[model samples]
Target: MDHVVVEPDSSSFSRVARALDDEASGEQWRAELATDLHAALELGVATVRGSLMGMATGGLDDGHEPLRQAVSASVESQVRMSGRGAGARIRARKITLRNFVNAPKRLNSRRGWRHPVHGDTETWVTQIGAPGWFDDPLRRLHARLHSAAARALDNRARRIARRG
Candidate 1:
């Protein structure tokens, strides 16, 4: 029999090995951590939504449409928070939203592998602050959304483990 040894370099095989290590140490602990992290994230999201909604309502006068416009403007401002000029603003909004939805799905699908606990946590934390903000409210909202999404994903992972 011939044996071939290969080094891990961001490959699926190494990923499986890492997961096995996590499971061997304690799957339950991992699951609990994931749950806690998820809850924190969800809380962040709610906070952001609340802040945005409050801002909209507080600014609204006799016209109800202004509230809707305010919400839209707030979100648009966050999306366009980056980029060079007008064109960059338009592109940034589309790209940011698209990535926001897609990135979570991609991370969630990785439940098949074992991830480093701290590594995953750091990723979520970094995501919350990924977008720089001139407006405090928008910055908070972005951070909250990121945290919430991450928490939701951790919850899903826990559910999956429970099923198995």
Candidate 2:
């Protein structure tokens, strides 16, 4: 025969159980999470934009100033959530940087380009620029962005607890 048993203390358990059973509280939590997540995404976008601006100017030739200006002017972000509450997933709305950076000339700047020397002579001269201009910063900042989103959710949980 086994006699040992384990259970949550009644007061704490009932408080949590009641909160979970309340539909309004669930909705409130989801709304707050969405808000927090959006803020985090905006922060991430701004940070990446700043980095991209620096990379564009510092790595590219002065002739590419337009690219730097475009980055500063055009970088933007949006966040969207799908599914309900607990199952919900937040994602950045599709980025439109492609429209600005995917053009034939821009793509060469992004991926790095070599010039035809002396009117298509046998020599090739590569230009100086930050290759992987768009992806490198994002890839570098991926961990920081994830932590920011997680911190927002953690803050949301703390906020809900305080309200409860």
Model 1 scores a TM of 0.25
* Model 2, span 1-164: residue lDDT tens: 67978898999777766755552356666676777776666755666556555663424343433655554445444444454434223222232342333332343254555555534568887655545555556677777768888898678666546544
> Which ranges in model 2 have alpha carbons more than 4 Å from their true place?
1-5, 21-25, 50-130, 161-164
TM-score of each: 0.25, 0.48
Q: Which candidate has the top score in TM-score?
A: 2
Report lDDT (Cα) of residue 63, candidate 2.
46
| lDDT per model vs. reference | 0.39, 0.55
Summarize candidate 1's per-residue lDDT along 1-164 as a digit string, tens digits: 59988775666656665665565357575555555544544444344444444431222244334432333343321121125741111111222231233322222232323323332544422222212222444355565656654665566566545443
How does model 2 score by TM-score? 0.48
Which candidate's lDDT is highest? 2
